[model samples]
Target chain A: MSARDRILGAIRESLGSTPRDTAAIAAEAAALLADPDAIRPELAGPSLTESFAAKAWGLGTTLDTVADMAEVPAAVSRYLAQYGLGPGLAMQQAPELTGLDWSALAPHDTVAPDEPVALGLARHGIAESGSLVIHSAPDNPILLGFLPLHHILVLERRRMLPHLEDYAALLGREDGIPRNAILITGPSGTTDIEGSYVRGAHGPGFLHVILVGDEE
Target chain B: MSAPAPQAGFKARAAAAIADPTLKIAIDRTTGTAERKRAAAVAAFSEFEAARARGKAIKDHVIAHLDHYLETFERNATAAGAKVHWAASDAEACAIVVRICREADAKLVTRSKSMLGEEIGLPHALADAGIERAETDLAEHIIQLAGERPSHIVWPAMHRTREQVAELFAEGHHPPPTAFDPATMVQSARHELRTKFLSADVGISGANFLVADTGATCTVTNEGNAELTTTPPRVHIVTAGIEKLVPSTAHAFALLRLLVRSATGGELTQYTTFHCGPKRPGDADGPEEMHIVLVDNGRSRMLKDEFREMLRCIRCGACMNHCVVYRQIGGHAYGGVYPGPMGAVLTPVLAGLERSRDLPSACTMNGRCAEVCPVQIPLPTLLRAWRGRSWRERLEPSGLRYGIGLWAAVARRPRLYRFASGAGVRLLRRLGKGGWISRLPLAGGWTGSRDFPKPAGRTFMELYRAEQSGKGGPS
Candidate 1:
């Protein structure tokens, strides 16, 4: 027998000497998967956006709120000016982003090895953990999230979920699991040296999120 | 040539570890901060206990039905374009990875921190296969450069001080760093590993948990190196233990909730990523191929034994952080891939009682490790079980066995027990000076490090009889 059969056989033997009901086991697995016995942590604060913002700030992420997507360019410019960053952005090729005119800012299609700033869109914002969920697509290269010194994510307030489980449930019910579904909670950090917290070890050192519009 | 055998056993290594001032300071500082942060983070969440219970329940269900779930996972993963391989031993696991790398014509590889990878000795195997691999996690990179194993599961180089790290960077980096600080050193590493990340032919990562429902492997990392490691490389190979399987994404998240809080005292790591398979059609950039290697390596045997509860471990390292013995001696003393309370129990089971007999006896049975365990694994009970097995199998020293046997003999007869105890107390009193014994016969292990308190000249039975006579309460 192959290693697979041997391992499975060993596991079956360990479980019991009696024969297993394969059909019953499969049904149980399907039932468990459909409704997982997962406990969702209660969201703090009065509203989802407040909770998300609180969590984001606690994890070393800077946040900006705009009235609408139209004002995103001005907000991006202001944030750059506040941090003394240039206008050149390695932006994702998403419709929401491409629809916005970028004449003032020089937006590139690819992320360079030492890209200073990159812009991407978040599919959902988790309030409990202050995390942004990103689903990879043809337009959304995974490198755009990793290669930049500063990551500016555009999250719509309407897409806010109360907990990570909420987003997970949505994914389970979705058409399929994306090639990469990442939940980014904060800027990359490490305490490897003397247990001291340092930001930007190998990914974005600074994560800036623009929460576009308020909850309807 | 094979590496030289360690001079002694766990006791000797622990003794040496306790005396190292650098390891002492590093462990003290790190464990103190980690304990405090974990307590606060756990307190911040109200559903932590519920989450932990749910997590354990899921693991129990999955492990009990592992054969079914493994088959299901294999089917789903295969459907999603992922090749799933099973290895009964560490060598088999490593060979599978090497074969994949060879098939991909891999010249260079980048790796994210995976204790399972260390367990399989992937680095040496890759070297033997003539593939150059880079350790991308900061602590892993430091230990890699220093030619050492990870001291702690979470903080791989917890035993190394900053000055030592700077020296490693000085020797490891091309143009040595001009300055030395956490940020500067991190930036220097980032600059160096970025090239390896972009150029490596394959990336090998360890799964934090594998969802059987979707056949997705989840990996959590604070540095985001795992993202780069898995994404940019042409072939992504996940080295995971079979025990990492969870029923679904929901179950994975529930366990993740407990894992991050207990591991780093954080709500979540910076990157909680789920990689299903290779890059899908029209995906701009991801690995062209993906493979999942499920390694057993003695875990299957553990399922039938009393140590089954140990499989619930999420590798949070919370047990070690809270363990009194672990904080003192640190991870290196355990002399295994895993360390601390979990290591003390697991090392003996995986490596066998003959090789790791001293590990089970290393614990004080304070039960703090069990209390802080998110999955509620009774670590002290497990350690005691190992001790029981060791004694029953005659794996312990004959001298210790004889001593226990003599005590048992005396205790079985109450009259002899009292007589022997009284004589022993009187002898100890006579030998002691200033109410303390600096050393005792046949107890060099105890007195070698610290002073032992002397017994009072009277036994408890004598004292009780004299008190009853003086009070006129008994004839």
Candidate 2:
């Protein structure tokens, strides 16, 4: 079962016995237990979203240039065309990516976000637990980042929230918002053997970054 | 002429580590909880960065003037009635320890988790001397019972699952328990070992941080087992890597903030112990004879090298827990007692490259370990540096060198780089179908289990060139 389904199932198990609305509890649990690997760095029409690299210092680096929608589309297409993200690619189109022209960079195969597409771009309003907040929806699937081999992501520079407060604020404004959210940062990596790192063990082998501007 | 004995070779032992699922689950849960706890602890400490910065600075200063601090520590510890011995090599260190053990006619020795003990192969050496060495840490005890070495630093038996424990516990005890209730197994082991702890002639421990100013050795343990080990023995022997010493208790206080949070994600270990020497004239309980054995054993060499920063480690195991590689494959896979990021940096230094050559080059250098390190050990940088040095020394595998050399050569030139990228994509496209490639050579391990997307027809540079030429992608 998918992490989303499992999380939903657990909440349903917990809330089914409750007197209050069960769906609300399930939605909340979905965000708490979202699949970590399904995050994506998407290249929609005008937003060039990429994955976050866990630099020694942090992911809070500021990229000031306000890029054009055309640049975003062009960047996405170029990565897809050269890197090849057609069949099993992910474009982790989250709520932050809702308004972009996703069809502009749509692959010929019409694959879902979880298919390991070219990239997935997600913006978490707050990331305290070494994760990125990605609110889910029909258009913004959470599975895109979790199951894929090479998960990429793009973060809006100004939208890099410190904690979880602003994340809730963003969710407060939306209705029936897919109730599921995810947090991703640096590709899933490990160092068990006296501290040697091996990439692509459980999650994406590669994670790329393309910071979008939110000030504009 | 033939394959070397498994006991004499580290690589052989490392291979054996992964085959045991019990060790693997213990490693997983241990490092998993440690990573989680560290994250939570850091979140709790609003002044964490300040604390880390101060701790790192204090330790670095102490290291810079180590000669002075060592002299001061020796003088003070000697005055406080603690005998100090400096051994430049493991043999010298081992000889000194064995001599002390023999003097006491020690039949049993209880030890806490000291990576130094593993490095010296002391337990085996003790066994050879007709002395029995018992590991006091819960995880260490489990690994000892199963006859295995530690894979993870914090939770020595982090790789083992609960069920495995039931089996191991059932093996030794006659009235063997019915099932492997984790708590029960722990309790039974505690009961079995409690007599040994009080009866042991000598107790040995590793210092988390040794304070020079107060001539005190501090150990942080959640179980407080190290304290028990030190207190009950007639002769207390403290073995530490040369790097464990800090200039003062004040310095220790600074490092403690990073140590607890980085190792196990607690505000503090359940117990924080500082031992100066044997029981004072009026003390209720303490060792009769105190010995602080300073083991330089590869540490003096590490200090002068490019990777000296690794010496700053406080054994927090943050690198192990948050480590992606350690999480899936576990620690024994690395083939050293250190395991995780610290192990990667340390194993090559202590064991030398020939036996542990694969360690440094194996890392992705994501810098997460360095980022979270309490003492600011530049783990990935050192790993990368070790890879570079290994080649200079001709210690690396020829195949890896050739492959990396070819990639490096191609990476230096744009035309060739693009050509290689294009060729790689073409080959991938030709062979990749149904979204997977089952038996691709050189990358078979990845493709055998999962799928590798055929590279897209474009390269990053090609698209950049197209955009520069005012030509959009071909429709």
Candidate 3:
């Protein structure tokens, strides 16, 4: 009779025996279709919220390349200064994050690992899905991805791959990042709770991005 | 040492697979999302075409010289204190793995996503051996929990919804309903598998690529499960096809760069760990021993066959993702662990066509699969080749054979064939509605979902003949 009725009829016909359980499944489907945030929240069960990828872009920032590394510490400093992550917060190293002056922001007393990163910045990024590709290597600390509540990433413009097929050109791609190159698109997110998404569940709560242009 | 065959057929299973509303929702949304992301991912590459060609060329080169690379890989892996085992068939592979599991007294095994394992039905063997093998990959674990094979390669449990997953988790072990939070699921899984990982006597992983130069193996995963799955275990084993090996790290990198973007629309996964050997000297947190089981398993046979180009496949599944047939029918319809365009060719070759005949004929030869294949495996051509094999093997249906034979007899003489076609068209047109053959004997399949454009009153040759001879006295 109606779209709902048709769907219900379809479900009834499909389920044969498992009618009620199928009803619950149908309702969940309707709810998921009805609103995504509801699903996101249910995914988190309204208990634990995880970060969305967009938030990760917001918390920490990015620059186009390592040449623009000079501007990154200042950007990271300003972002971190507001939050006071400077004096005591720990900094994890990424291979791409190497050559950046960490001392400028915080002189000493930094923790190495966090249950969730406060600030996580990726060393390499592929522009295709706005994915951040991180390889676990010595300089590129694996802790940066998992630890900290806030995360900031410095992505080189040159490193951004347009397609998944473009990685054939990377040096030592076979070896991969010696440590861990975490290709992160967004902040840590979880839709696992009840179907609703919660950001910053296990990883960074915030993701700030700084897209470094060629001239900038 | 095998589980009974899954009773349901492809269409039945696929229909059942999409029955879960949440799962359907999840599949539609996730696949839709992946498609969009893939579009964006491809858009960034100005040289996508060139990359495809180059990657295919590299893979082709490797497959061509596979024997050389395999030998190199063996020597290097042996040099690195890794023992290499070769299995000529799925049974042999399983036998080798079970023997290793037995020898090591490995009561428990944690495995990362190994489709090859699914192909060989490894879990049943492990079950028969009474060795617990836990699927470590989150998606694989979900399928493992369901006691079902993976429907999609890249996202193995691509068809499951959180609620369905919750229900699965609710089964057997219930602390509460399954959490939908991807993170919680991760944690729940981590919580559940934490003990498994810690206590696992052995770890088994499938390599994304095997580096011959360094005797290294790589497994890529989004979660850190792969790392824990291998490092914490006492004995770590890697299983893969011989073609998985490349000459050097450079070649492996070449494959890796394309793997994530092509499969997951990411530049790379979070964890792409390389398991070289057991805890080497000072390596505190790693496996005590490492062994690589190189499974030939019908591959070398294919190497000398016409379908040898299929060996270059890196299992990236772009062809699967892009195939319209696959998108409509879904993966399970291929009736194998491997599905889509690649599966159509591979299923028959690897498993024998008598059991896998439906695969080759299942396709419409749309050519989209070949367009998307990273290694440029001419999937349709390979499907045709398989069709030929089936024909030669007398697997073709009698009706189809008779019809084709009749058509061929008529086609031998162009005049009779044209007359027959033209006369048939005219007769059909006479009975047709509004110039289109909306229905016909055995032709309803063509008109079921789409319209068949009306043929002209006369054939092109007839028109040409009249025009050339001026028989109609046209101005």
Candidate 4:
């Protein structure tokens, strides 16, 4: 027998069922897939932007609020200046970012191995964990998130969701799930060396979020 | 050389751990920090207990109908262009991975930390097949450099000191740094691993949760090495246990909430990525081919018996962090891929009770493991179950069996037990000096570690009887 057959057979034997109820199994799977009865925490008081910023800040993520998309370049430039960095920023060719006038900054399409900065657009921001949801696409490359010393994420405040369940709900509405959807919470950090936390281990050392639109 | 054979028994291994001051300090510092962080994170969430309960329910539901969910996962994954392979044992799993790598013509392989991968000895398997593999997790990299197995599940190199890590890097890497600054060491590793990630033909990672709803394999990591390991290579392979399957993304998130908080005390890992399959036509970058290797190394058998609750483990490492015995001895003393309370129960189930007979007995039955377990696994109950099984099968040492048997026989008769206890106490008083027994027959295990406190002058029964009789105001 094939490994799959044998393994399933062993499971059947353990469950003590022969010719299990196919209808019940189908119904259960359908129920689980349709809508989740997930126990989500009550996150009501703070507005989505407030919760997102507070939670993100708590995770060591810096943020800047922009009233419109046009201000993103200035925000990025200012963040870079604060860190004593300049000019060359690797970014994806996403339409959301490409239309902006980045004449003052050198934006490269490809990230070098030791690139100092990269910018990506987030599909959604989860308020529960203060994470940015970035879907992989032709325009938004996945490497921009992991290959740079500093990562700047542009998130529309209106796209912020209250919980991870909401993000799942949003995906349920999509035509098809993206090949890769990463929920990045904070800058890369590790406590592996004698339990000391050092940021920027094999990923961006710093994560800056550009939250567009005024708070409700 | 091959790793030294496991110390004779849990006692011997634990004794050695107690003697190593450095190991003790390392274990204390690491577990203490993890415990504090977890407490703070869990406290911040008002609904943590409810969330934990939901996590348990979801896992239990999935495990009960595992065949259906796994089938769904395979179908959805295949639909999404991922090839799913089933392995009934570790060898088969390793063989499947090796075959895939060979077919891909992979030479250099980058790996993220996976306890399941360690259990299957994937690195050794790949090395024997002439495939070069580099561990990307900082702690795992250190362990790989030292040619040692991980001492802790989450913190693989928790047993290593800063100086030890610096020395290991100096020996392993070209042109090591001059100082032992942790931040510098991290940067050095990051610089070294970047080339490996960029140039590797294949990347291998382990999934923390596999979503059947979307056929996505998810990995959570703080260092983001998993993202690098999965993103850069042409082919990405996920080697995960079959038990990682969850019914939906919502369920995965519920467990993820508990996993990050319980493991490292973070609200969420730096990255919780869901890779549905290979890159799509419109995607700019990702693996062109993806493979999910579902390993069932002794887990199917675990599903059959009273010990099935062991499957509920999320690998949070909380059980070990709060365990008294594990806190003292560290993971190496457990002598298995997993360690601590979870290892004590799981190693026996996977490796057999005869080889791991001392593991269950090593616990103090403090129940802290169960209390802190995110999935609410009744760890103390499981440990006791293993102890009962060991006793029934006579897997325990002959001396222990004889000692327990003698005590059982004497305790069955109240008068004889009283007489024997009284006589023993008097004899102990005679032998004891300064109210401490320096040595005793058949108790070298106790005396070897520290002096045993002498018994009181009279047994509890004697004192109680005297008090009941109002004799001499009960001494």
Q: For each candidate, what is chain B's TM-score?
A: 0.95, 0.92, 0.88, 0.96
Q: List the candidate 1 regions with Cα displacement exceeding 4 Å.
A: A17-38, A172-175, B1-7, B430-436, B460-475
Off by more than 4 A, model 2: A1-216, B1-27, B470-475
Model 1 local distance difference test score: 0.89
Estimate TM-scores for all models: 0.96, 0.65, 0.71, 0.96
- Ranked by DockQ, the better of candidates 2 and 3 is 3
lDDT of 4 by residue, B263-360 (tens): 99987899999999999997889999999999999988888887789999999999999998888888888888999999999999778899998898
Indicate the residue-level lDDT of A18 in model 4.
51
Docking class of 4: medium
What candidate 3 gets wrong by more than 4 Å, as runs, is: A1-216, B1-30, B161-163, B169-173, B177-192, B426-440, B443-475
Q: Indicate the docking level reached by candidate 3.
A: incorrect
Cα lDDT tens digits for candidate 2, B1-475: 1122434444444444445555555565566666666788677566677667666766666555555556667777777689988776677778888899999999999997788888888887888889899887777887788788776677676666666666777986555755566545654655566666778999999888776755777776654467557766889998887678776543564566577677755444434556776666544346779899877766655556666677678887788777776765677667777888789888887777877777776566778888898877788888888777878898766887789899999999978998989778778777877666666768854664457876666777777888877866545
Which whole-number lDDT from 0 to 100 does residue B417 have in model 2?
91
User: Residue A81 in candidate 2 has what lDDT?
Assistant: 63
The digit string of per-residue lDDT tens for model 1 on B1-475 reads 1111355678878888877788889888788889999999988887777777777887888888888778888888888899999999999999999999999999999999999999988998999999999999999999989888887899989888888889999889877777898789988899988899999999999999988879999999999999999999999999999999987787788788899999989989999999998999999999999999999999999999878899999999999988888888888888888999999888876778899988888888889999999999999999899888888899878889999999999999999999999999998887788978888998878787777889977999999989998999765
**Against the true structure, what is every candidate's RMSD?**
2.4, 25.3, 15.3, 2.5
Comparing 3 and 4 by TM-score, which wins? Answer: 4
Displacement of residue B179 (Cα, Å) in model 3 is 5.8
Candidate 4 residue pairs in backbone clash? none
